[model samples]
Target: MNFLPITKQEMLERGIEQPDFVYVIGDAYVDHPSFGPAIISRLLESRGYSVCMLPQPDWKRKESVQEFGEPRLGFLVSAGNMDSMVNHYTVGKKRRRTDAYSPGGISGLRPDRAAVVYSNLIRQTYKKTPIILGGIEASLRRMAHYDYWSDQVRASVLMDSGGDLISYGMGEHSVLAIAEALAAGIPVNEITYIPGTVYRTKEMDSVYQGVCLPDYQEICRSKEAYARSVALQYENTDPVTGKTLIESYGTKGCIVQNPPAAPLTIQEMDDIYDLPYMRTYHPSYEKMGKIPAIEEIKFSLTSNRGCFGGCSFCALTFHQGRQVQVRSHASILREAENCRRDPEFKGYIHDVGGPTADFRHPSCEKQLSKGVCTNRQCLFPKPCGNLKADHEDYLQLLRKLRELPGIKKVFIRSGIRFDYVTADKDPRFLEEVAMYHVSGQLRVAPEHVSKPVLDAMGKPGHEVYLSFLKQFQTANRKAGKKQYAVPYFMSSHPGCTMKDAVKLAEYVRDLGFMPEQVQDFYPTPATISTCMYYTGLDPRTMKKIYVPRDPREKEMQRALIQYRDPKNYELVKKALELAGRRDLIGYGPKCLIKPGKGEQVSPGMQKKSRKKTIRNVHKKKGR
Candidate 1:
């Protein structure tokens, strides 16, 4: 475990002993404090168990297990940053250029390496330690999934990793139950009755079924079904192994829907905000002056949860449920105060926003009845009329925070739903957000310029992004502020093709704004887009379309976004030629290639030609 504050030697030297019952091993971005594993670990600690948190353990190393010295390391918990399965898809089989895990070569020590290393280490040292794998990685991929890297479906991580149990979605209740049972000397296999857990049968040849929840099968059949359920349903089988899923039926798998945002009690918000955090830099006294990157910090407080925009590529509504869960304004203020007081405080707060920072509450008051309200435009394909739209309270909350004494600046870094911001009947909120909250660049995911791709991704439309861009620019100009909208575009999404990518590249070029940051669609387990990417269309809608499933093509399409870069010119050319979209050449000022020119050779060829030309020119000069 590579911990920041306390060195392994320091823990050993101080004679700090391992806890008696639990050992948690997982990935954590310090900023995401309310994320699954961290929240679950805190819940367990609150229950009075001896818990050891090994944050972001280096599971690739065999020696990483030494962090837990050996006090009967009862149970191992596995939940990495996002879904481990999704992380596997990005790197496990297909090579990714921007993949953080494997940048240069296909490193064999990934995907299952974390699970294998931890399980093998514990088995060798602890002999009979119980290991449980959960989180999106394990849950959605708990059964065999289409292994893009392997080009074949493989068994779920639970079966492949050889763990004792795999708990799926929001494991707070399930983990606590498991911990209580373990403390009482309950056998691991007997705890199969627990909901949101997946485990192999006693024979280790098959899976066993647990209590089934409602509408589970419907959600897994297709993206539309999952969307209809708002991703609160779970349905999937191992794509390769075809093994029968044996976990509790209808148990929303391990997708933990967040508590609703509306009607938030002040006390609950206080409890969440007041939680202790190491806010300051732990490395050195001198390094304390500099703030850590947004990626490096421990503990992030979610001001709200749940989204209504319902983009197809997103899983928030399904995971957190459409109902918004907001912490009280005062509670957020207290949390900020606590973070500032921490010895780790570097005088900076990462971000204070969620799903859509502007739309802070359920779109309608009908949320009190759990009835669908359809006031706002249905962001999803089948827009629900029951959806409400409100940003007033959220705006007030933002204003209150700016007045906080210790806070230097509060950032709305979480990607905002721009359509909602523009839809806000009140311009004051947008004005304040532009003037006070924005850190110069606001990230808005317009996703695509093509209407079909936008529709598939559940975005409003390309025009909406353009409209928002105009409004944002106008707002900035009115305020004498030069803030820009950093539109987040996705390549190779389910309904997107090479042509779509080129069109988007042209659109961005036309806007005279080239985004350095672009997101390649990563099909994680249970995301609607992931399902569509693999199966080609919504299984329920039966709408057929072209999907760029080939990893090479996906890469080329992604590179086309940076067409102006000389290095990426060939990639853009290849992408355009491959898509038969050469007509778009020189469409905008950013387009590097000239019209009617022969397709330039590869960079290698160009380099060789340049050398030959230079040598011949030198020879002529010598003569």
Candidate 2:
């Protein structure tokens, strides 16, 4: 019912001499399950351990970390919910105007490389205090990985941050285990044996049966080696089938990653979500303004925690693993009921799913016992034959939420795997979602239309998307609703050529759809797509691929997605020429854009530029 203490006085008011953990985060203090710091702090508090939240502490001064002094056990550092670089800068490496995670939606609140910065800041004040890194930044960067901003392979965050350990992935199980070990007076250096953690050590004698990856220097020297390392890491993501991975940092030390912690059971998932969360930003920020991130999730319910869709561009496989762990219907209903009780409740539940919304259980029953297959995906290339592809449980859950009092609409705002929908034998789930869950337009990610590009992105083919679109329209018509399917597409992905970009633009023109926003491929750390972007080699297959890294080319690819816009006319025209599709640049029905005056057209082209007269010009000017 109460927010965790953020100030020393607040801690003292709660009668704590010193907190068991001082959680230093790079985001504003928002005590919601959606925020990692909130969950860890609340979970610790539930376990009789006091925690003081130190959010967005000033990295310029060491005294900022000295606010609550040293903790009884250690300092937990996280770069909030997102990686600091990604939060601060856009895919084009331009600084963003605002930060959704900061108070008042302001920018420049947290330093770049926040986990490393915050951890170093803490080390300045308390030299010997154990600093344990967590959250997306630390989790994905727990090894020597590619850094897009710097264009170099960086060391493990555990080494750079001077942190004793990294509790990677969804750290509920590992963090709790770490707390118990620390509380038992175990030294931080001796806590390497814990699962779902990474630590550095000089001696590898004790590392039993660990898989030795190429040294940091080796990967830094050879892109092929780096690609090989990424492939190895990808294969060992399954907790049940993973092995202890060790990587040498030359004379500095070797970083060892313990096998991931086992996926949470249904009861454990329920218990974690059931934790008492104030579920909003700290009240002290009433004047500063609202935390923008909370608004999206305040009324939402997280029904599941893992994804098996195996999208190459996504970091879910490395972070949350491939196993899908979900909460019981009762637990989700309880959370939804609480949302309804809030004064801000507007008879709408914003979302009711997790990483992949409709995934209610493990992809296959065998996943519950043996874990997902490392070699093949459940719903990539094609859905595995063993894939259950059931939606009845999820459908029932949605039905119950809709029937709840004071709830007029319960939306599925999260991304749903359309391929999975097509794979299911039962059509009721798609029909019901189109009829009830969609808010006029249902959002889905087709990513790209080109086979080579979609293959590189590890997404379903255009045919699959086409089939789903037909089904969606049919369902909407049957239900007497006029909903639309808003398919999301990405640009500049590896293996995508100007020809492919033109193809996509032609598709957009034919459909008469202009996307308001487009995602340009960003090479964040630890993703298979990022690996391809960096090495020009597919980590999965080691095949050489074409990668577009020039900013201008990337811009043209992005502009192709919104070719209808006036601002993108020049870029779209340029892209069409480069793709050898000059025929698509005139007054023809299939043309992406009309040829402007003075623009040259290829000889024998069906669509050609025409000279505009004085009368035509005056007409355009409304004369």
| Best prediction by lDDT | 2
RMSD of 2: 2.8
Q: lDDT per residue, candidate 2, 40-67, as tens digits?
A: 8889899999999999998998899998
- Candidate 2, clashing residue pairs? none
**Model 1 misses residue 463 by how many Å?**
2.3
RMSD for each model, in Å, please? 8.8, 2.8
lDDT of 2 at 500: 95
Off by over 4 Å in 1: 1-18, 26-37, 55-73, 83-113, 124-128, 184-186, 192-196, 199-273, 280-300, 317-319, 342-348, 364-378, 574-582, 586-592, 596-623
**Angstrom error at residue 404, model 2:** 0.7
Tell me, by TM-score, which candidate is best.
Answer: 2
